[model samples]
Target: MHEKDHSEALKARIKSPKRASRRMSMLLGAVALGALTTGAMLQSSFDVGPTPAYAQNLSAQVPAATSAGFADVVDHVKPAVVSVRVKVAVEGASAEGFDLRQFGLPEGSPFEKFFRRFGDEGQRPAPRRYGEAQGSGFFISADGYVVTNNHVVEKAREVEIQTDDGKTYSARIVGTDPKTDLALLKVDAEGGFPYVSFARNAPRVGEWVLAVGNPFGLGGTVTAGIVSARGRDIGAGPYDDFLQIDAAVNRGNSGGPTFNAAGEVVGVNTAIASPSGGNVGIAFAIPAETVQKVVAEIKEHGAVRRGYLGVQIQPISKDIAEGLGLDDAKGAIVARVEGGSPAEKAGIKTGDAILAVDGHEVKNARELARDIAGFAPGKSVDVTVWRDGKKREISVTLTKMPGEKTASAETGEEQGGKLGLSLAPASSVDGADKEGVVVVGVEPGSPAEERGLRSGDVIVSVGGKKVETPQDVREAVKELRKEGRKAVLMQVESANGARFVALPIA
Candidate 1:
């Protein structure tokens, strides 16, 4: 027989339902026939066994050990997760007629009569539109204290939490901190509630994690993944240090707990990155440290009191550092110190670079801001600053940031030269402080203009030294050139604010 005929015969035999009991036998017979045909064509021969050797040795093959499953972890943490539902009042006109067009029911259709018994579609005043939203939360105390996202319960007229076992309870907002997007809620239960504790330490990247929450209104949903990244700043707030995970966290997962391998709450799932409004593997969680801190303050005082340093600061750019004769670009450059603020009282001057706080090194402007805000008002701290090519430590006693709106001056003079600018003493200009030289005019295409120096700007300091008279500015520039410096750092105070400008020394 031809090889094609043999192949066709084997295919037909395998497809025959009558060979159901002999399915394996038919498969083996087909393989043997194919092999025999090839052997005949190639003029070679081989033995055909009743069964394959690999199949016979299946019992001897051992599978690799599998990692522990997540069932136990889910069981331990699922009870603590709760689904939060909120009802918000909506404002609009109420339609009072049965509008057939709204329900897609043809005008005067027979089906409309059947549905009319259910409700007068047009006569029903748009049932006082109540906006309904759902999210997730977890119990933090046995007495019924719960933790959820600030946005979840924000402006909610009625907040309710449903437990894993389907028991629902009305929850009241105890406090909320919008800066960190955290909120605390309370529920009343008779016996007690299953609560979870925040993890003492943060989870490492690549470590296994489980996110348990009510995703898409599905109660007690659990997803598993590893910590993808940490300390992610997505610009959600001023103190944004979120933990990024690859778990399938979707809508309604907000304010839920992300547990570690030990079933400890490592973070609170808050937001997700999805272009299609579904889980695409990227989600963000507020670290447990921040949650703990914010929660404690809320529980104690019913609000979060943040420490603030009254100073306008900016990051030290490469050009600013080079102009200031620094080897590395680090620390925050003090742009303007509030007149009566803690920084001003502590002798923290304009143009000073804040390098450290309480002996802890500050990396940049954001770090400095975060560190300062971590402390409480009326607390004293040691602030180290880099000034005049040297470091100096100053003591500052923080004060509560003012809640009221705060309010600055102007100048003139003309003196043009290699710097391509005009300067005059502030005393010569009206409404100007008599402490620096006033810039009356700037050459259209001069280096001063290129550096953002404009007319009416006051040059408060040059090369780390304060300037009083127009001659003081000229002398500073001459001294910088004599020292072989390529550029001079000028602290200019304008109506907008005070900032450092690096001007080239021609």
Candidate 2:
């Protein structure tokens, strides 16, 4: 995949570049609004869990910044960034026909609460259209080319762009990529439009950065902070190499840009670490290095074609690291190699730990996936791996993404100590039950394993929340932690019947 095309890929997923920035913004906004409504729940959950180690006995308050110099950066970048408003034609069947009554009763249930919260479902007929959703975006080119997250523009019938100066332009989507959540849009505007350029160099950690975006329909808001961290993954997607900044990014700032000291756009301010909609001093940015490449590719091509390596890989854990006889738990460990894949053709085998790709270090599976996906199909690259206590390198040609099949394993190997137990998708055995977590293998002394978890026991719920997939388990844990719950009450299913168990968690 071309570098410029990747951001475009990000754009394409979000909507078009013009609407994507706003789309990505809306996703975060929804999370915030949800959090705000459930703030009390989150606070209660926190009190129930073990206190954060970092906060133990830490009572001193940090002093506020004495200087207001950073405000200048926000003022400089605010003009180029804008709020995007979109009017989407929501089909009546898609929005109204969907049943909300099904979600109300269960803890992990999706819909019942929706009907109850909104009111008597039968009495209130659903609206024919969802009306309009507002978001944010920024200008990238002087010729009126704009970049945003794909989501903001997705499903929108009409889009409008508004700058800090109150100038508005009716926008049109160019293309969108759902995978990366980025989008591109163009407006019929005259030339000589003010635009921001992305910085070429990597912004230093702790370096001052400025965030500008519209927060909750509020226009032209600016906040400042330092780069908190880099390459932070928030479990949002596969390619989550976010630049974590300390800047205060709120709901409306979704598609806005995060700028470096030179006034160049360094990151697309996307998400923040907050239990509430307000900032908690941790925000994420789509790095400029990744953005520039995606933008350029979207400009040239309508879509992004990413390279694929047909293998299911996971992070090397201490157990696997010991089992594999490696020096340390680093790089991506191939759990299963797909048949007839580039890995198979290149002789890459299961248990082969990938160290690097094209000389770039492969820290983990996601990094390897992102790096491999960074290339177009048919591109060949060198891969270094550790097999049988020896380092070996293999050259493999990249393939198309959707063409590769994801392999399933029988062990709960890669999820680490996050979820209670390792599980695989349930497969029907004619007379066997389906639709629950099938415990293939559990770690000895683990919470689940210690609780008499067996190879075939199916988990139906966690802390009264249903467990459907690994994602569900993760969300349950997160919700448990948020609610200050000490133990996760799970309903387990087996060949005989269903029973409940509480798994204690720290």
Q: Which candidate has the top score in lDDT?
A: 1
| TM-score for predicted model 2 compared with the true structure | 0.60
Query: Which window of ten consecutive residues has the lowest lDDT sum in model 2?
Result: 36-45
In order, what lDDT does every prediction score?
0.70, 0.63
TM-score of each: 0.60, 0.60
Model 1, range 97-183, lDDT digits (tens) per residue?
A: 234556776666676545434454235433444777788899876677889888777657688999999999998877777767889
Query: Which tens-of-lDDT digit does each residue in 348-431 have in candidate 2?
Result: 998788889899986666666777777767889999998888998899987655411111121233422334354554542223
Report clash pairs, candidate 1.
97-122, 97-123, 98-121, 98-122, 98-123, 99-122, 415-422
Stretches of candidate 1 exceeding 4 Å from the true structure: 1-66, 91-128, 404-506
Once fitted onto the true fold, the runs of candidate 2 whose alpha carbons sit more than 4 angstroms away are 1-68, 90-130, 403-506
Candidate RMSDs in order: 29.0, 20.4
Candidate 2 scores a C-alpha RMSD against the true structure in Å of 20.4
